[model samples]
Target: GSRGSRGSRGSRGSRGSRGSRGSRGSRGSRRSVGHVGRVCQAGPTPSAKASSRASSRVDRGLSQ
Candidate 1:
C-alpha cells in the first residue's frame, strides 16, 4: 500500500548520520596532518623535507 512506499524514505535519514561520521573522519585527518607538520618542523630529515614542502603547499592552499 502507500504506507509501504513511505517507509522507503526513512532510509534517507541513515544517510544524514553518515554525513556526521564523515565530518569526524575529516577532523581526525586534520589532526594527523598537524602531527606530521610538527615532526617536519622539529627535525628536517630527507623525508621530512618532502613532507615539509607538502605541508607548506597545504598551508598555501588553505590560505588561498
Candidate 2:
C-alpha cells in the first residue's frame, strides 16, 4: 500500500510538469522556443547578377 501511494505521488509530480518545477509550475507545459525551418542565404542567380552589374555601370557616373 505504501509503495502504491508513493508511486502514484511520483507519477503525479511528473505527469504534466514538462520538467520545470515550483514557481514556474503554471507554464511548465508550454514550449518556450521552436524553430520553423532552415533558411537559405544563396546569392542571386547568374543572370540577375549580370543585369545588376550592367545597370551599375550605366549609373556609376550619376551615383557620384
Candidate 3:
C-alpha cells in the first residue's frame, strides 16, 4: 500500500540520487583541490607527490 501510494518515486528517487551525488561532489572537490595544490607547489617531483596525495584523498573520501 505504501509503495503504491508513493508511486515508486519516493523510495528510489530521494535516497539513491541524493547519497550518490553528495558523495561524488565531495570527492570531486577534494580531488580538484589536491590538483590545484599540486600545481601551485610545482617544483621537483610534483607528480609523484600529487599522485600519492590524490590517492590518499580518494581513500579518505571512500571511507567517509
Candidate 4:
C-alpha cells in the first residue's frame, strides 16, 4: 500500500511539472507574438511581409 501510494504521488508530481513547463512555453510564444506584432506595426511595407512570416511560423508551431 505504501509503495502504490508513493508511485501515484510521483506520477502526479511529474505531471504537474510537465504542465508548468507547457505553461511557460505558451507564455514564451505569446511574448514572441506580441514582439512581432509591435515590429509589424512599426512599418507598412514590412508589416505585410512580417505578418505572412508570422502566420507561417504560427502554422509550424501548431503543427508541432
* Model 3 misplaced stretches (Cα beyond 4 Å): 1-7, 35-64
- All candidates: TM-score: 0.31, 0.27, 0.42, 0.36
Residue pairs in clash, model 4: none
lDDT of 3 by residue, 1-64 (tens): 8868686657655554566556665776587677666676665256546655665566456544
Across 1-64, the per-residue lDDT of candidate 4 in tens digits comes to 9999889868765665456545655775677677666776675456545754665555445543
Q: Give the lDDT of residue 46 in candidate 1.
A: 65
lDDT of 2 by residue, 1-64 (tens): 9999889767755542323332233332132211111211343345444654554444443332
Ranking by TM-score: 3, 4, 1, 2
Clashes of 3: 0
Q: Which residue pairs in candidate 3 collide?
A: none
Q: Lowest summed lDDT over 10 consecutive residues: which window, candidate 4?
A: 55-64
Ranking by lDDT: 4, 3, 1, 2
lDDT of each: 0.55, 0.41, 0.61, 0.61
Give candidate 2 misplaced runs (Cα > 4 Å): 19-64
After superposing candidate 1, which stretches have Cα over 4 Å from the reference? 1-44
- How many angstroms is residue 11 displaced in model 4 relative to the true structure, after the best TM-score fit? 1.2
